[model samples]
Target: MRVFGMGSKAWLLNCAILFACPIAAQAAQDNGHGKNASHAAAGAHVHQISNHTTLASGAKVSHALHTASGKRVATRSFGISCVPYARQVSGIQVAGNAWQWWDNASGQYARGDRPETGSVLNFRANGHMHLGHVAVVTKVINSREVIVDHANWQSGGGVSHGVAVVDVSEANNWSAVRVELGREGTFGSVYPTYGFIYNRPDTGVVLASVSRPAPQPSINPVPSDLRPLAERPWRTMEEVAESPSTPRHTIDLGINAGVSR
Candidate 1:
């Protein structure tokens, strides 16, 4: 009803506009929520991409087309040990096994649990990794994510670069890490780390040196046992010799008799 005697049609029209405005606004708000949900999904996809580091050409070939079948991806590089590779690339200058690099850098370089670019990430030895491992950090994406260059992680002393290392430790410390392998954006192994060895922290990404000699494993070649020693027992030299029966044939003891032609 109109209070000021306004026309019925006009009053109805005014009421319709008032109610329609809120309804339209609510519909727009609902559409906005839908748009926000789509944006959130896209953001999640981008974050997943960020988890993967750049893949090397060889690694790409090795890991490309891999599936969740739990199959192995073989690296092309013949053999590259982590120690020398870390030394040359990161310039840490430490020698010996990768596990030892942490302690080896004790007085020589600064060491810490945080990730740093160009620092040597020292992995602790475990049941699977007897000698441990070392890798040169090329980029620190965040506290828990980084890209690394190392040798012999997969291949026999084969070098791999631009691999992702994610800190999985409960304390947010880099005590444990999962390595992105085969350049396929797949993480194969989770390793325990001692820490990062900081020397030339500012050094940027360095390519793998495929020309460097791979770690040569010592080989002792022994001649094959040609004889079946079990079948033919050999006598020791200590057995005493028996002299000729003194001469039941002594007639034959004469030198001339022994020399009978």
Candidate 2:
């Protein structure tokens, strides 16, 4: 949970690396292209669904593609961003798009404004936050405040654990909140949010249970005829020859048995 500003030195180093590595720049550009394509597909799907459904609150619903397990399919790496970070810690496989998490979670996960442990608080895109942000609730202090763990809140990319977030909205609905800056216990800027995404198991598409091979019985019953062989004591060459129940073969005399000539 170390928080530090992206100093000029680090910035210059990053610039130099980007300038020197053409492959890295190309890869970043390709990733952006893929993200754009995914967003376009999600937008088209949302548009198609919106034409048939009518909203009671008149609020525009966000939409994104989801996996069969009800988790969002991420096209890129889950680095120092609130979306994938929350998803990783919360055990919720949500998509890469942070702004559309609430709408994408509709009927799949429980949504509310109240803070709960393991729930993801989804923020809305605003002037300060263009892509929106998400954080996993770690502890609920009271009805007014809670602690969360998120990433990339500071200049240098890293997780901010146990950061206090308070409901500062006029309605006290948790629609707006001010998160603590680092471990300073001081509230930062106010940011608007959609709501909290609860980790509910009962809803959404039920995944088929994987049938495992039944464990083999530990006590293997040996046949009575083989019991003597299983329990027989070790026999020397002379012992084997003397035993009436055993057969003997001529031993090779060339092999030495620790006896000096």
Candidate 3:
């Protein structure tokens, strides 16, 4: 295994894990319709492809998880109550498919090789880069619990949720995961701006154990986009708890009133 961040280099000798280093964009091509002959390690299991929103601020976002005909991909992210932002980053584009794949640097399918602790689960679009997220596989508990740590997750970075742990199973082909939203360590906010975990393969699981700093005052002014939500009535502790359903995915839960399915 190759490491990128934090100056530690340790190899997990069991399998050779090859990743597209630097996490940059690859050449573009039409999404996969052909069977990759060599790198058939089992394509990734996709969950759903629908969009998600922020719970607190009522912000809406979307990702590259759309179809060639421009349909919102179906995904289990919202259905299972697990945040889909990270999944979107991991290249699970179409919402309901649950099993898709993209090519790696060696021009093979993502799952062509066994994934490492901090591999960037990617989705391919016609041989080019379409979408993906940064995820650190935190655990491998009997195929029942494969905890992944990731942040800056949004439906295409539409809304931001902090890094979080999810329960995955191979039995379902890893298509669906049980997500733990608002689990404390997933996200961080600093006044008008926020920061989430980005693609950091060099520092995969090693950084998973690292804790985020407290939200600090930003040296820069807050962006104007957030002013309306930020200035909205501040909810008391009880008001917030009472209306918990109102803040799903940071979008005004009410925002989806007529729009939600």
Which candidate leads the pack in TM-score? 1
**Weakest ten-residue segment in model 1 by summed lDDT:** 217-226
Which ranking of candidates, highest lDDT first?
1, 2, 3
Off by over 4 Å in 3: 1-101, 104-115, 122-132, 154-170, 184-261
Question: Candidate 1: where is the Cα deviation over 4 Å?
Answer: 1-79, 200-261
Instruction: Determine which window of 10 residues in candidate 3 has minimal summed lDDT.
Output: 187-196
| Rank order (by TM-score, best first) | 1, 2, 3
lDDT of each residue in 1-261, candidate 2, tens digit only: 133455766888998988979988899999999997886565333211111111233432222333464422222222486776887899877665888887888767878776788999888876556778888887775555666778776655556655566665545567666665422223455567887888985365422213332222111111111112332233434445666975555545676645543
Report the candidate with higher lDDT, 1 versus 2.
1
Cα lDDT tens digits for candidate 3, 182-229: 322122221111112223322222222132321221112211121124
| C-alpha TM-score for every candidate | 0.48, 0.46, 0.24
| Candidate 2 lDDT for residue 259 | 52
lDDT of candidates 1 onward, in order:
0.60, 0.59, 0.30
